[model samples]
Target: MAESKVLYLQKVKNQNVSHILHKIWEHEAISRIELVQMTHLTSGTITNLTQELISHRLIKESESISDSVGRKRVNLRFDNSYYYIIGIDIGRTSVSVVLSELTGNIVDTVEYGTEGITNPEEVLALIEPYVHKLLGQAESRKRKVIGIGVSIPGPMDQRTGKLINPPGFPGWAGYPIRPTLEERFKTKVFIEDDARTSALAERWYGIGRDGRDLVFVTMGMGIGGGIVQNGRVLHGTNGLYGQIGQMSLMTHGGAGAAISYDCWENLGSIPGILKRWSGNGDFRDFIVQVRAQEPHAVKVMEDTLRMLEASLTSLINLYDPDVIVLGGKLYPYLSPHMEAIVENVRSRVFDFVQERVIIEKAFYGQMQSLMGAVALVFGHVQENPLLVLGAD
Candidate 1:
């Protein structure tokens, strides 16, 4: 009984310390008195925890500021230069790796095409050097690589950390992505679905940062979504929460099933728009023709945006997010018609929902997924400071 009580008290103290550390990170730099006020922790406890964090090199004291005449108070800030995080975005067309500081500022980046790559072995080999290259940079800077975050296509089993049969990638079903990366990197690895990471990136670093409720929709190679409610990414059961691409527009779905079997992806994805074109042109050409007012391209895009409006209406009615963020290759095509799209969506949905929900472009643009990876690592550290501090 006594041992259990001691354990409970220790857990409580660790939680308080972690909370204080996160508060410091959020405020960028804050005084000890401010931490005490914000966290409502006792001054002695704040002093002791901050000193412990400083000793571990996770945080440090900055230059003193004059709080009063003849009196100075030291400010506490996260030691951003002390550690580094690697964020990897594994898209269908390319793989991108970024080395970011503890504060999520990107330091360096490398990208490579996966044109001929098919299997997990090839992916592992392709990413290995990029990881090592970034590690070399970290060594030169005298900073340790603390964590690696990966954003891959979805239907992942979050509990097992295994990706399950992601679309557009053959033989990726049940791939041991997390364990494989952990073994190679010798550090904690966090994996999330690409769309979810994009949403998390927005929530942690961009426009969605100030709001807890937002939905991120990706319409590039495929149509998908990520939902953030009350500042938490909704993983749902089996990590399939935000597979909005599969949302059925008809009674029966998938190819060759008739018009009643269509899904949102078939009508709204960038590839979907390209399918309507007779020429062998890619998404870029399709966008070019649309801008040139080519009749076929313009008609396809207008129809696609109408489909987008219907799908978005369902999403807004269901989730009621504060903002609906749009991204992917299709964004460029949609931007010019945003006013029309917004008006169309408003006409279809309820007045209250249409008035409240704002549709905006992705804040970080192409960097959203990679930055989300960095944020994932930082979130883990914030939740378990002891793990990073070598206490657990």
Candidate 2:
């Protein structure tokens, strides 16, 4: 009983230390005095923890600053070399791997085609060595690879860590991504819906940081969204809260059972548009041509915007987020069409609701999902004492 009590007390102290270290990382450059105030930990405790962190090279003291009152304070900042994280964005056509520091700076990146990833084992084999090589180039050993975060297209089961019948990637359904990656990397791994991961990226490092309640909509091969309320990603009971592409928007409820057009993905997803306009060259390429003032491309652009507007209007009415961020590979083409989308939604939605919601494009662009995966690891480190102490 006495040993158990001692272990519990030690665990509590470790948790506090981790939380304090996270605060320092978030603030970037903070003084010991400020840390004491922010963490409400005694000066003695702060000194001990900060000393341990500095000794481990997890944090370092910046050059001292002399205040007007003849007092000098040392600023503490995260030591970028302390560890590294790997972010993997596995999309339909390709997979992108980024190696970044704890401070969120990219060290190196590699992209490879997924044309041959029909077998799940093959996909893992391709990813594993590339990650190893990237870490080798950085001269970072396995111990320094803190975590691996994966972003994939999904109608996924977050709890079970399974991709549940994702329309975009047919072979990925029920894939045990977390365990597979964990086994390969021999480290902690996280798997999340690409849209939600993109939203997490925005919240942590992009525009949504200013707003507590926000929605991120990705208009790409498939249309999907992620919602952040009160600074937390709201995963529903089945972890599918942001799978908005399935929301029924058409009056006819879409073509037929044989066609699989009932979901919003069939109505507004990029592929859906491509299927609708079979005569068109690539829809994305056509959009670019339209933006450059090609005449035939104009009609395609108009029809795409109208379909997107229907989905946007439904989301705006339902979530009523403070901000709605548009992103994904297709967002560039959609930028010029933003005005039309806003106009359609404004005209359809309740006047009072329309007045409050603001729509904008994602500032981070293609990197949003990748960065969000990093944020997942960072967020986990922030919350877990065992991980934090282990990292230090």
Candidate 3:
């Protein structure tokens, strides 16, 4: 009978632990008292779970505190350093690898030109060494790597973790990214659209912290968006919810719809704009001259702004998001154009949405997607501690 009671007690403890882990993930951080109240569990239950978490290095006592009447209350917080995640952002011209703590802080990053990406195996080979090297520098072993998160140019099927006709990356279509990486590293892997990943990063760590519904717009080789509603990314039936670039903004009877007309990629994609304005000149040199405010360069900037304004207006009308965030390589050059775009949006959007909507540049730098991939790993760990902690 004593042995039976012990087994039953262990089962009860496991259930209570599952509840505590869910609460922490939902709240991000919580006090012991708050956890008790939130879970409606006994103080003993909370204490046991918290002790277990601490022992497992899942959480740590935080430096931040709230002063109580007697002893100060040292806050308990998730220990992001307990593990690390690898984030890969593969763009048209380059691929970037970031090693980030569970809390989304980047420990190290490596950017390499993408001359060999036509061969998927070659790209993976190049990435593996850099990842191992970074782990060595950080004194972290492969066993500590929680997962690998990859963000690439879309359109992709998130459910299958495969690229489906990715525009810029011709050879990557139908690539078995998640399984390939998982097999190679002997670890879990996640794959997501680049724009969607960026949006996730903004929602958790950047400008979207205060707003639940937002649209993250990426203006680079092509334009795309990621939509978040009620704190969850809106992955559509096809797992491509926010492919806003395909929308037809202009009435041109082209292969793309009307929304595609105003899309920066279609009319003013970075390469497209350079091609349009460079006039047989060196495109890189032209951009440099534009940055220096040469007279012709000023005209190119103005043209880019006009297209941007029109595209933003269409987005505001369609989505009515709480906030619209501009990010990607082109963001720096387009910073000067924001005011004009905002004004255009105001003029174009209906009064109700115009009054409530906010347009802003991304708060996070170029590495936002990499950080988001870390968030994806940590978020999963928090949601299902069973994935980390075994039964009792």
TM-score of each: 0.89, 0.84, 0.82
lDDT by residue (tens digit), candidate 3, 1-392:
99899778766766677667656655667788888888899889788789888887778767655556665565677787667788887777777898887767778888888764687777777788887676565554543777778888878776777889888786888988888878877778877888888998887667665446899988878888999887667888877688887665443434664632454566667776776576556556777888788887777767778777777777777777888888888788788767767877797878766667688888777876667676566556654565666655
lDDT per model vs. reference: 0.82, 0.77, 0.75
Candidate 2: clashing pairs of residues: none
Model with the higher TM-score, candidate 2 or 3: 2
- Backbone Cα, N, C clashes tallied per candidate: 1, 0, 9
Among these predicted structures, which one has the highest TM-score? 1
Worst 10 residues of 2 by lDDT: 251-260
Residue 20 CA displacement from its true place in model 1, Å? 2.3
lDDT of model number 2: 0.77
Quantify how close model 2 is to the true structure by its C-alpha RMSD in Å.
Answer: 4.0
Which residue segments of model 1 deviate by more than 4 Å?
1-7, 63-71, 250-261
True lDDT of residue 294, candidate 2: 66
The reply for model 2, stretches above 4 Å from the true place, is: 1-11, 18-22, 138-143, 209-211, 251-262, 288-300, 343-356
Candidate 3: regions farther than 4 A off: 1-29, 37-45, 63-71, 135-143, 251-264, 288-300, 352-355
